[model samples]
Target: IFFRSAMALQLPSELWDIIADSVQSDSLAHVCRRLWDLLGSSRYVKLNCDSHCVTQRVRPLARNVRALQVKVKGPWDPTGAIDALQHAPFLHTLTLSNMAADVTVGSARAMAAIRTAPSLHTLTLNLGRNALGTDGAGALAALKDAGGLRTLSLDLWGCAVGDSGAAALAQLKDAPALRTLTLELWGNAVGN
Candidate 1:
């Protein structure tokens, strides 16, 4: 009904902010372009799109966004995704979740991108059922360099980091501004 009708309309991009779940995979870039075109007049300031759908759509709006949440559906490609985020200059908080088993190098590169995000202070990487391994651990450990970061949440319940991964995370003691850290490894071999 309403969802279908909205999807069919050719309304101005400024009309997107009022529609919930207004993002459609095929039309993301067009909407972003319209938003950019309407810059000051457009009230839509926050965006949540399918991580895969926006991979190609993000570059145009990168400099205008304030927050971003990327949900990986299949195997993660760290380099490609992180490379896209590098264009976002005003990003504050980033949340990456629902990653698949192949998210090794991509996960690391993603963390590295967060470290360089000047305004990023809060990061949440939900790797509950993915396979991050030692490489993932090293990548996450590198985030301590993000000077503005105050909180970090790592959910590695079923990943492959094991005890060595735990050791890697323990090295974060030097992150002076990190006030809270939550690591979820309940189902993983982190204790072994």
Candidate 2:
């Protein structure tokens, strides 16, 4: 009875706003299908998707997505994820990772998409054990344009980034609002 009544309750849009603001839409959406639909337009949903089916799942929920996490497991084609992000204009946080050697310069294209998202405040990328050399780090320099980005955690461990790549990364100091920055470049060729 409690579950049915809760689902059936039709509160005013104002009341719903109060409820939605205090609670995360991701957890509420998991309670039932009705709640998911109710929160379909809420900008608090945290969505997790893999490279495969990312376009399908993210496109529909793009407007509602506040945080997004994508992991590249198999072949690393960034096209789908890039397309999906274009629709998510309100997305504030993003986490992308590929823990294998296959993640290559294609990730540079992903950075291009990221640079345009002004609403994004936090970004975490773990592209470890790949072959993204100086060029890839140079691509990351585009984050200097992300005016709202406050936190950035980049794990390019063993991605063959030498001194030149480090210099490119140093350009992030120009990001206006960035307050916290973490770079994990261990197992690389960066020198003093």
Candidate 3:
């Protein structure tokens, strides 16, 4: 009936463009993939996706992307996602948000992988509402070895890391490339 007729008609070019733009505006990651497919090449200069989707999609688009923002959902296994980021050879900025403290053990592997990204200049991890504690901070501090990293931000607004965690993060003071550091702690105490 009407549905069949509509399906038979070819969509006008203008109509398709409208749809594509709508999709792109709705979700950055989806737009990246769609543009990649439509242009037969990659065109995304910046990208934002959850850790899981990034692990699944970023490898193919890595060569063309310059900046990346990753939001990790709670209860995540940091190792797999971190390994996926390592595959991106040209990434310059990385933002990890909503990481779970309970997953720190697996995150060690991710930390190791991040240490190897030659182009990563900025790293931000938001543990604001999760479980990352002193141990987790210690593990993240290990990234000081990443030669190109120049900026780091850690947010632990609702966690249980006290002075011990602050001490661990202080280790970054010696990082040769680190030029900026930001730490946010709300519900935790770090000796005033």
Candidate 4:
């Protein structure tokens, strides 16, 4: 097959880029050090926060990744995954989905870490079912630091978000590049 033959020939990075999509690009980069240098630094990287090997994988590529997604579930704390943001200076798009915060302190710390990524233009936080109260919502106010953020999406459904929490999120209106905003607060208690 064309795919197998191409891999056997060890084509140049440009040819690999033309033939391989993002997911396939990851595999090609691991073929050899030369390919890794040519393609790995530019590829999008994703890590499951619950993975035992995530810390090792993230530390090496964190600085080069442009788009990063950290997804977590169950009882595992996502603090370590959020901390990875500190190393990603070139990050443009970030997604932290399905994270659970048992207290406002954790929420505040997580947002504080995310605020450090100045290059972020698009951010999606899926905090649904996390029970983030008003104080936790206040923590999201830290997003005001994302100077280049253009699109923001927050899924706080069933998180017990109230009017005051909603007010806290309103602080994002000051973000200069922000043009699109999506807030999913369906099961929360926000009054008109």
Candidate 5:
């Protein structure tokens, strides 16, 4: 009975905003496809969804996405989520939290995309499980030159980012709009 009545009401973006802000992202997204579609539309400022959602349901309507938090699984993970960055032109903050060693072959392209997103303000790459090594560092080094970024957070916990990676990050001292830098290189080979 309640379900029927609730479904009958047309939720404006305003109401969606109220519900979305109050509910947990993962739980809300799992509630049903309708709610996901409602909150995932171009109206939400911050979105938390998986790669598949980004590729299929979110990207096409991502023009308004400002802050996005996504989970990328290792090796078998799809790369379409990275490609979706191009579709979201106005993105300001993007968070790629590591659920596994997610960064592999496609990360360089995504890092490059960060440079391209003119309005991008903050970028968080938590490379906890990946073996970014020097190669990974090089791939992400490209972001140091991006002038529009206000916050750049990289968590390389256990990722083996040696001196080279550290060197790459050091170059950001001159990046234009960078205001906050959150770098966690715990359990790496930086001192070795």
Candidate 6:
């Protein structure tokens, strides 16, 4: 009796496209780098700006990015995050994470960068560390028009946002294509 060997089948590009499209944008980096390597040239990417060597890492994938997130591990300049906006013309989603009390993106440069990102439609700002005061909220509210925002999530855990700040965020709902909104304002002084 003789044994037969099994043949390996390579998946088609269309099937890969479907799989890639189904992946949640937030879960990209966690999906294993090897899988991304297997996908080769056509693999989509999201900019994850952490405390690592961000400059080198971002330059290459900047053009292909569809979504972007800036997470500060230590003291990171807001300008670095703002500069990234210029490279990603195709970017549609952005997440700015400032997990430190001393750091805030309330700079004019950052606001200008947000204005330039016409393709941006989704925004998630985790401004828990730095207090996203009413001023901060107002600045971000202007971004609601950036690419006709579709989704917005503000994790203002320690932000001192009273009625006025919340009021500003409310304007985001009036955005052109807004479909989802999340507000986390724990320990805030928002009175009814």
Candidate topping lDDT: 2
Residues 1-192, candidate 3: write the lDDT tens digits.
Answer: 532355523545455444544444323224345433443333333445555565566566565444566665545566655666666666677776655545563464365468677678888877675566777667777877788889888776766667887787788777779899887877877786
Can you list the residue pairs that collide in candidate 1? 78-106
lDDT of each: 0.64, 0.73, 0.63, 0.70, 0.66, 0.62
Model 6 lDDT per residue over 1-192, tens place: 111112111445455445655673424323445435543332344445565555555556555566666565654556664676655666677776657635554552363356466677777877775665777767767756655677778787777777898888788777677899898877777875
How far off is residue 30 in model 4, in Å? 6.2
> By the TM-score metric, which is better: model 2 or model 5?
2
Candidate ordering by TM-score (highest first): 2, 4, 1, 5, 3, 6
Best-performing candidate as measured by TM-score: 2
TM-score of each: 0.69, 0.81, 0.68, 0.75, 0.69, 0.67
C-alpha-based local distance difference test score of model 5: 0.66
Residue-by-residue lDDT tens digits, candidate 4, 88-153: 777778787665544344755575567667578889988787777887788786777777889999
lDDT of candidate 1 over 90-143, digit per residue (tens): 566677775554667565756566677776777788877667777778778887
lDDT of 3: 0.63
Error of 2 at 9 (Å): 4.9
Better of 1 and 5 by TM-score: 1
How many Å off is the CA of 170 in candidate 3? 0.9
Give the candidates in order of lDDT, highest first. 2, 4, 5, 1, 3, 6
Per-residue lDDT tens digits for candidate 5, residues 113-177, read 56667678888877776777777777777787777888988887777778887887667656788
Q: Candidate 6: what lDDT? A: 0.62
Q: Which digits, one per residue and each the tens of the lDDT, describe model 2 over residues 103-172?
A: 6666665755676664789998888888889888888778778878899988989888789998888888
Superposed by TM-score, candidate 5 places the C-alpha of residue 136 at a distance from the truth, in angstroms, of 0.4
TM-score of 5: 0.69
User: In candidate 4, what residue range of length 10 has the lowest lDDT sum?
Assistant: 16-25
Runs of candidate 5 with Cα error greater than 4 angstroms are 1-40, 45-54, 76-79
